[model samples]
Target: MSDILLSAAATAACLPYPALADELAASLTDSAVTVPPRLVQPLPGGASLFVMPANDATVAMTKLITFTPANAGTGRPTIQGDVVVFDIATGTRRLVLDGPTVTAHRTAAVSLLAAQRLAPNTRGPLLVLGAGVQGRAHVEAFVAGLGVREVWICSRSPASAEALAAHVRTLGAQARVVDNAAAALPDCPLVVTATPASGVVLDARPREDAFIAAVGAFTPSMVELGPAMCRDLMACGTVVVDTRDAEHEAGDLLQAGVDITALPSLAEIVRESRPRPAGPVLFKSCGWGGWDLAAARLAMLRVCAEA
Candidate 1:
């Protein structure tokens, strides 16, 4: 069979947030799925290339992408690449999807899955830090999957933030661009941090029952939430990682010296049927191959349904 190449928009069309979340939820406990550790290699000028591979009984995929920190605010995507999917049984190439699109949407879908279980309250308005690709994807996910109606955006770049606000408005949600994310924290129970920061962006304390999805700062050297905030979450709230790998890649938690071993993972929550926490919930996502696999599987199912 001929391999199908899907553009970013096309790839996105296949992996709707609600459907993608269901796929992720199922894959989390799927014993047949195998996700190997992603490899990150340093590129010239401080950029890095990532290779993430995963497979299940029917489909296998590898996501190859480049992350350039310097590309922030440059009108160019910081993440760019493609995901190649193959038939597990025949080892035949089946599909090629836009990598960055898969990354953003799948990452947000994982957060949505976690929120379905962890968020104390799903009501809006949702506060999102950063105005890049992941920021846009999260806004779409929360609005679509959780029915969040209002979105408050905060970013270091005002222009980018407004652009994100415009995008939010297009999605039939009320959008507000705030200069201070910390100032907006108390009133906003649902929060997402998607920035590329070497230091803290959200430091202020939030409400007692807030739900925060921290997706930025994958490396130990990069941090978005303040160390103190991380500590407070650990002491008074519940911290959930997308995977056990966050113990190594989650900068905010690592910088604060939070013991990740004590925190539950998304997979565990799904498998054990864990309930929502009484206090605030912090979901730390460091990316996982299994998530990409979920996206690919969803897309393939869509492809077959359409055919």
Candidate 2:
């Protein structure tokens, strides 16, 4: 058939947090899915072009986007592009989904899946570091998908933090803006660090049994967790990576000298059906193309059903 374009709103509407999370959970165990290493090419002015492609038995998908760090606070999005989906049999483009929307929702859905399987508690008052796009997506995921009652937001920019907190409040969850995210760690068992930090944001040690999802700092030079805290996470709790890609991209665990190979993949945890560990659970997500593929599949299904 003809190609269909889905805007940001339409893309998000098709993949709600609950259904998206379930799609990701199922894709994790589907052996037919194949995601290759995404290509990141650096451009002048500190911009990056990312090309991520994946496929299953039915459709092939590619997400092409640009990441411009200099755009922060400039009213321009740092990530922008489109996800093109094609029929595997015909090789004809079937759909085009908003790139950043797919990235934001899919990433958050992955985090939700990890939390549902790993977190000690999915209840309220979760602490979130960073108030950017990822930060907002995560808050919506936790509150809507996991039924969190309250959210504690922290960010370097006061205005941004308050914005996120305000959004959280509108979602019917209590929102708190904190000057020190580390200080709020003990009370908020479920924590997410979505900051694009070159150093550390969460410097304090985590509670013995807290669940933390570190989504920012994908490169080795960037990190959100302090060395002491990273070490403590491994020593006192189990650290899981969303995929093997974290070994190369997960700065939080790498900078702390944590052996990523020793950690189990999220797929393993899902398949084995193991009991939750007694200590803290740190889940490091570094992004994957299969997630975008899952988004495409869901969007197509929803679109077709509507048609």
Instruction: Give me the overall lDDT of model 1.
Output: 0.92
lDDT over C-alpha atoms for residue 50 of model 2: 94
Candidate 2, overall lDDT? 0.89
At residue 131, candidate 1 shows an lDDT of: 91
lDDT tens readout by residue for model 1, 46-99: 999999999999999999999998887677888999999999899988899999
Candidate 2: segments with Cα more than 4 A from true spot:
1-3
RMSD of each: 1.2, 1.4
- Candidate 1's C-alpha runs over 4 A off are 1-3
In model 1, what lDDT does residue 124 have? 72
CA shift of 67, model 1, Å: 0.9
Q: List the residue pairs that clash in candidate 1.
A: none
